[model samples]
Target: MARVRWWGTGLVVLVLLILGLVLPLVDKALGSGGTALAAGTVIAVGTERAGARPVTFTVPAAGWALDEARSSLTSNAEVTRGEVRVDLNLVIPLGSLDNRRLWDGLGRIVAMGGGRLPGGPSAVTTRHGTAGLTGPLAGHGKIGSATVFTKSDLGATVTASGPPDAYGRLAGEVRAMVLSVEISP
Candidate 1:
């Protein structure tokens, strides 16, 4: 019994030592990793074949910033470049977590990335006598049930708008890259 108790005490001490040394490093590693991931995703989107001139944007209402830009094609078909800015707000279920909360989920996810508006300078480009976009977008929403749904589910209306045919297709990729991204909280 004495020997067994000694062994147990030794195990506990070893566990504590390991935890004390590891937790802080783990937290820091996670934070840095999140930053790198976000950066890479943004850069990739900026470089896509959508058009040219990549720019980043910041929206105060959404509490986030994203990189964006514009592009073009061989054909005279023009584009506006990056033309939309989104600001996201997060909300939680006020009533219950059941059906009521499920319904509340809409307001939250809809508010995800805040709201969209006429994008500003960096992302906008003038070509073919029209304006279009090809860039990155960054913003934040809230956490809670609504957030959960946004991550797990995104709707069609969330799709982007741009030129047509090839240029439009490329712009769609940029939008996909933007939406797929989720900054660390």
Candidate 2:
């Protein structure tokens, strides 16, 4: 009876150990796969221009994380929380590109990528006093906004999207993040 008890205890411990190891994997598979980023974390986006400051934005709320696999410093940066995702990209126009032209171009690019800008662009100013254009974005059963902030030859575009409910719940946070963008002189 003592030996049987020992064996049963060992089997239970082994099962528990296996569960402990496998549960997190299952959770990750079902949950967000990236590492979580704390609220208030400032993230630098885009490459630094010569003798110019690099652009950066703050994570306005908790539950966000940098999607490392889908992000690249030289090209673009993507961050996600739950179903919502925010993407930032730096644009350098080959010629003189006005805000409206840039916004239109970005819309075309979005359409090319199987997305659509359902609304026209409207003027918006970031908290840092940068001027930009913003409009509705929809694709892949998600809805959000696409905004472009320009300063001289350099421009930065921020796109945020998710399911309607999730996007609505996090709209303020997303707006805060977009407004928090800073393009230093």
Candidate 3:
């Protein structure tokens, strides 16, 4: 007869328990593979130079100003109003990478950074192409939204954040900004 080992059983149980706790998170991070933007209308408020690169996009609100903007491996723009801050990031991959892959890659990076969309990743249409949206995740000093899109060799991410009260006030305009994003040639 084979002897039963309690420690072995306990170890197996522990591993299972850990997986049980982690599986949901992993599943959430992987997403449902269904793409649906949350119900809201994206509004376009204005336009500005997005980064040091010659690229530009529509701003969702009127008061935002470029505090600091630059370009390198990634082109980044930071806009601010009161305590609210918005960051626009653009990356032009030197090698071949398509939109879906680029979106997923950025999604994983966002998830690892503890930035989670309230509704997780979803499908949304941008000026350029279909993109992924995440958050309402926590940002530097407020709640924020992250949107990622890719076209040809370029991948872009926009993060908008502000104080909870202020964010609530500007939420619709912000959504419009996401909808109105247009990359300038």
Candidate 4:
């Protein structure tokens, strides 16, 4: 009986070791799968260019700009679908990212469709939205029903594809960041 028990323990240990070594590969394989790749590609577009002059994000509100903006990547995950978490702090300028109010965080407009606005000194129109995007490499869905944050601290969920459709959904980034912009009004 003791010998049998010893054999069982050995088998369990071997299986555990195999799983530990093999699971990572399996996860990687899945992560590289079409679905995950698509999702990641979609999300990365908006975030990747965050450093640009006007930082834009989408929230439930629709579209709005801030005086200033700051963003950070909190976490990211790969599964059947990809998921990424980014932390952000934005201040609406009296104008756009380049211009700012004399004070910070004061008079900052919380936008929905875009997080940070372009620093370029130009009158930009922020697009507000509440959309549901869905499709293959490129998604096609109703953007109105989707909400963005910049506008009114509202929540917007984006359901779209990545790449190709550059403006359509901002490459799957609309849902993650939906905020409103503040106008001179």
Cα lDDT, all candidates: 0.30, 0.86, 0.60, 0.30
Better of 1 and 2 by lDDT: 2
Residue-level lDDT of model 4, residues 1-185, one tens digit each, is 35345888899999998899888888887554332122223222122334432233323322222212221222121112123222223323344422222112211331233332222221223344322222121122212112212322211222222234333534334433432322111
Please give, for residues 90-129, the per-residue lDDT of candidate 2 as tens digits.
7877998777888989999999989999967888988889
Best by TM-score: 2
lDDT of 3: 0.60
Which portions of model 1 show Cα errors greater than 4 Å?
1-4, 26-31, 35-123, 126-185
Clash count, one per candidate: 27, 0, 3, 64
Q: Least accurate stretch of 10 residues (summed lDDT) in model 4?
A: 136-145
Model 2: per-residue Cα lDDT at residue 97? 70
Per-residue lDDT tens digits for candidate 1, residues 18-93, read: 7997877887765422111222323211222355412222211221123222211111111122332222222233
RMSD of 3: 16.2
Q: Report how far residue 56 has shifted in candidate 3, in Å.
A: 2.3
RMSD of 2: 4.9
Model 2: per-residue Cα lDDT at residue 66: 92
Per-candidate RMSD, Å: 17.0, 4.9, 16.2, 14.0
Model 1 C-alpha RMSD vs. true structure (Å) is: 17.0
* Residue 160 lDDT (model 4): 28
lDDT of 3 by residue, 3-50 (tens): 877998899999998799888788878643322223332212222335
- Which residue pairs in model 2 clash with each other? none
Comparison by lDDT, 2 against 4, better one: 2
